[model samples]
Target: METTPCRMFPFIRSKTAQSKNTELTVNGSSSSSALYKSNFNLGTILCAAAQDSPQKTAIVYDDKIFLSYKDLDVAARKFASLLMTGNYAKGAVPCRPEDRVAILLPNIPQFCIAYYGALYAGCIVVPMNFLFTEREITGLVKDSEAKVLVALKAYGTEPTKAAKKLGIPILWADDESSCGMQALLSSANPLPALIPTSPDDTAVILYTSGTTGVPKGAMLSHMNLFLNATIVPNTIRPVEPDEETIVLAVLPLFHIFGQTCMQNTTFARMGKLVMLPRFEPGEVLRTIEKYNVSLFAGVPTMYIAMLRCPESDKYSLGSLKMAISGGAAIPVEILKEFEQRYGIAIMEGYGLSETSPTCCSNSVRQGRKPGSIGHPVWGVEMTILDEKDQPVPDGQPGEVCIRGHCVMKGYFKRPKETAEAMRNGWFHTGDVGIRDPDGSYRIVDRTKDMIIRGGLNVYPREVEEVLYMHPAVAEAAVVGIPSERLGEEIAAYICKKEGHEVSSEEITEHCKRYLAAYKYPRKIEFVKELPKGPSGKILKREIREWHKKMKSKL
Candidate 1:
């Protein structure tokens, strides 16, 4: 193998040039620069890193399987060969460029192999949540029009059923069966080279959480994901020359937060990734200490669980350099307490599946803001806009708008919705936020999640922030419930800490002291736990369903 210069920090400098059939732009006008290569493929990051450091460990799974970069690259090539030659299963056809390949797996090594393999073959990769049922899997697969499905053997039943119904072949990983991915890899020859792909070619199709309606697949191009994976780390805190960056991959790989920020970013820097199939507070701490992890990223709820873990202090997490929080608005109270307890700064960022998931982040060099999402990274422009699509002044709340190299091309097969979101050359985020005079942004709440009671607007995040301050509260979700008098009344669902109990009246009184009459939750319900998505974000949609059931009973 020829040695390739490790372009660890491609965006460090700026140059504009033209490649084969496309224009390449590398500019330093923004705080973060853009690196757009016309003849580029996302899978090359792994191949280049492997050539640069073949013997270095790339992935450590469950602290048992340690895969070197060379081994991982070879495995990805074998899988690509399987896709390109139509040798995986009966009735399978050779995949063409832009073909959709669905992946239904967890945060294991096979997920990485299959993901990069599909990209190497110049196919669009579609990742699905492993927890989805057969119905959910079938719906997503059918919607994506995927030519093939790759899933773990343990979770293959539902995906296989979906594949059969859709007339697509399913490849099982980690199975001793004759049809498993390993068996096919043993019989297939490694692809000699990665298929050429243009920077604008769609590389991934990430589905949104669909809080408003049906989930839409966001189309991210090679340039979008590549720029985000490289720019975010340099903008926030670049890895030092002598330092070894080890990332703990507890966040679900299917989610954008983990896929781009954690997995792709680690590969871009030639760092080691420690994979955990699921998030358990105790197991997370143990893994971090055992592997001497330097970087960690997770949602707000993960931090809350780790803070509340009784055995968290037993592990000396001195190696942790920083932690990132996203996926939701983290309460200021919890952020402060966790930082004080663990002595690690939690840098909050903001992005969506459409923005390659890392547009705005609190920078280490700029100093940390307690509640702000910080400024836009290099190559990204963010502003607050009013309902008229006009930019709003500083300190005023409006819809957050972003335009950047990291933004997705558009939603797949939904031109109308795409046009609605990408109006005025900026993507309307649907999130209400305020911008500081210094350019920092703070999330107010989602426009759909805001509650209006008696002609006054109430943001659930503000009330939930106060609720998190309660000593006995472990987790809290605030929502707007139906009311005959007011348009919508505030409701709080509280999950108390273990061995601690608090009444609804006590919780209401605590909120009353801090919030106004309409801002405090009028009805408080104590629950054992709150519904969370794959990334451990509190799901208000589920809570709303519970409220509907309770109202029907009443």
Candidate 2:
């Protein structure tokens, strides 16, 4: 495939101009001046697209609900009007500018309408995972201090229960019920215009995964979401002006990867989005073939499932132009196999919820490396820094730090945590990585996931990557288990492929061949499947907890 050098933005110096030893940061800024705009609204992307292409199909859901750009815009405006007027039901209060409006729904059309509607009303959007229980919903609602919630009745009574407990009004979006979003939209007039918003005002409060502890809301400003949504697509794919870009939305829209990269990016380009409420490998493959999906963005596990689907050979995924991976580090073996089989490039990127979720990515325009999360996106600078926040040399592993237009405002209502994370003007991502000689970055592992056995440090990704190389290994997660002798011993949880069998000793020997004595997994346990989050990233925190529970029983 043909490739170009990474684009250099006008506002920042080129990576080549900086000394690799003194400043190991890679800059992926382009020459677009709009990136530094002062006043902007996240909702403007949808409005602008609607104005430009009123008849264009904006979203296609399950081959049933097809929304034109104008239709989508009108629905969003109506929803915004309802929020502004507080006329949806009794005891409802008008949502003021910057007020948090939580949304608990799946990847349906209602999610898009509510998300943009909240922003159009100049309200901060708090997108909650629909899978969250009543207690989890209440905790997030209390933390965000959300004024109202837009949820689906089909998701059950949890959302309503949480809203009632908090004394906040909840709007239901049930297609089957009369008291749904459609009824509310029909009764309410369309909002004439979007509320004026400053670029610095928080548009969305995306809570962290809370893998370590309590989830904190990351305050993403209009500018942060705007630039990231604009840069990532232009850098990676660069859709033609007249080209029809069709995207598959299987990843949960509540996640930053799906929100900014898939939804917002597609709208900015006047592209069509095919929505799937849930990801079943067969359904995803069938949809891709049915819609001629040109772009797909998902977590690593999503790719693995589609690749391993038993009847995958029947589907001709020729329309797929590129596959974007994020949310977690994809095993290199899976990346290579999927690419070779599908005849498409998988561009892996890296970021946290705090960075509006995309700081670095492997671009088609900019040459992509297989295992590396390519250079920083346009207007972003990423560098590996030591514990003291000093720049680390190229090829040396350190905590990845980022700064530029895409960094979030701060953790909502948590000044001390924000201060600690944003020390020295750079948002310190707890991910350990090494800067490649070619200006790309490779994630080593999470700082907390690193295991110290005897006196040697071992990255679980390194072990997991090797385990993925084994033929019978269908999925693998490596975690550190407490040890009385070695501080912590490396433990591997694996899922084997169907009709294949592999002993723990065989898996151990496979790792021993590639890894050092201290780095290899000392304990191996086979399971039917590994636990995954909403976006399909493996949940190491849950695995550790399960291990603890089993140990107590022993």
Candidate 3:
């Protein structure tokens, strides 16, 4: 392996380049001076760490299945050895750095093994969400043109049949259950050394849920994800060895947050991971109390369910030292109440799939303020830029722009979209927000989702927060509907608690008490469920489509 000088690494680019978009400044400081790189790959470093701490427990599931550092190393090595045999060649013809390999599996131990196995074999991993429809899964696999796929028994032959239809080979880790160490113990060629990859090398290509159009693959490199894995852990809370940091892994590993926080961070620091196949509010509570888990990461809805649990007082949740909420803006009401009830702080962070997911996070050590996503993680530079690409004044809302090591390489094979996103070296996140005098930022709304009612700009987050204060509302999502008078009027989709019902007029009346008359929801639709994306975020685009369909019928 060739070692490159840190200064010469391509990941660290020049910061003084003139911006194609106008510069954004807040309180006499310009966003143009900040720069970042996407150059560190985490999996390679973590596997090396496993060799360093061979006897330490690295993974624990169901409080029974445990794997030490040594055990993980052996499994990965043996799996990589198996992959190296038969028609496999590192950096060979037809398998260049740009080629992709699909990984279709549930959140099992083998998922980690297969993920690292592909990296060890020098192939870019395309992690598929296991719950995706057959058509969706097939579209992603075919679009990415993946050569090999690895899955487990829990995933039936459905994916296999799909792979066969595409003429791609599907290898099952089913033998893992019965074989134990046999496959690993069998002598095979030594695992190859880490491949020489630049900061620009394609690492993982994640496909976005195409609510508006065909799904596009977001390409992230080793450097992109690796930097996030290191920077996020260091920025939020320092990892302490022998601290007994048992993490409850309920978030799907396919999502970038789980991939970095639960898996990579655990390996980087040698912490124990307790895996859950699926999230059950009761099961999650039991696992935490039983394991004395220290670290918990989840979305707002998960926290709401746990706090609202009928037996909430029965569980010993005091063991949780820190929790992180992302995926969407958490209501300020929920934040205050959850902390007051649970005796633990829920730190909020901001990121997108395009940023290798983490850019800013609230600090656990620092006292948190309501409705803030804290400060930028180490090495991240955030700016609130106006439509002209100029920075907004302090406490003013604009599009949230990020420059960081956690940024993804580009949209896979889509240069035009990549160019539009990565303008002037900074990734243009479409979400709008405002930076505080203290450096924290609060998301206002999506750039396109902001409603202009009677020429009064209303952020849905503000309106949503007011709706969340209602006791009968279990889940709520706000969208804009076409209106002849206001151009776009606020329409809300709400899921009420079981045995609890509220009329649209009453809901609107409740909002009118808390919000401006123009900002209050004018139309409401009661639904059993809201549309959600692969990562558990409300799919507002779907809601908009539904609204359009319903209006067309009228």
Which sections of candidate 1 miss by over 4 Å?
A: 1-38, 552-554
| Residue 375 of model 3, lDDT score | 89
TM-score of 3: 0.86
lDDT of 2 by residue, 88-145 (tens): 6568887777999998889988899899989988899999999899999999999999
Between which residue pairs do clashes occur in model 2?
9-29, 9-30, 28-378, 29-379
Between candidates 1 and 3, the lDDT winner = 1
Q: Indicate whether candidate 1 or candidate 3 has the larger TM-score.
A: 1
lDDT agreement with native, every candidate: 0.85, 0.84, 0.73
Question: Is candidate 1 or 2 superior in lDDT?
Answer: 1
* Number of clashes recorded per candidate: 1, 4, 8
The window of 10 residues in a row where model 1 has the poorest summed lDDT is 9-18
Arranged by lDDT with the best first, the candidates are: 1, 2, 3
Write model 3 residue lDDT over 490-535, tens digit each, in one string. Answer: 8889989777878988898899899877889888889988987655
Model 2 regions lying over 4 Å from their true place? 1-39, 175-178, 552-554
The local lDDT score (0 to 100) that residue 416 gets in candidate 2 is 99
What TM-scores do the predictions have? 0.92, 0.92, 0.86
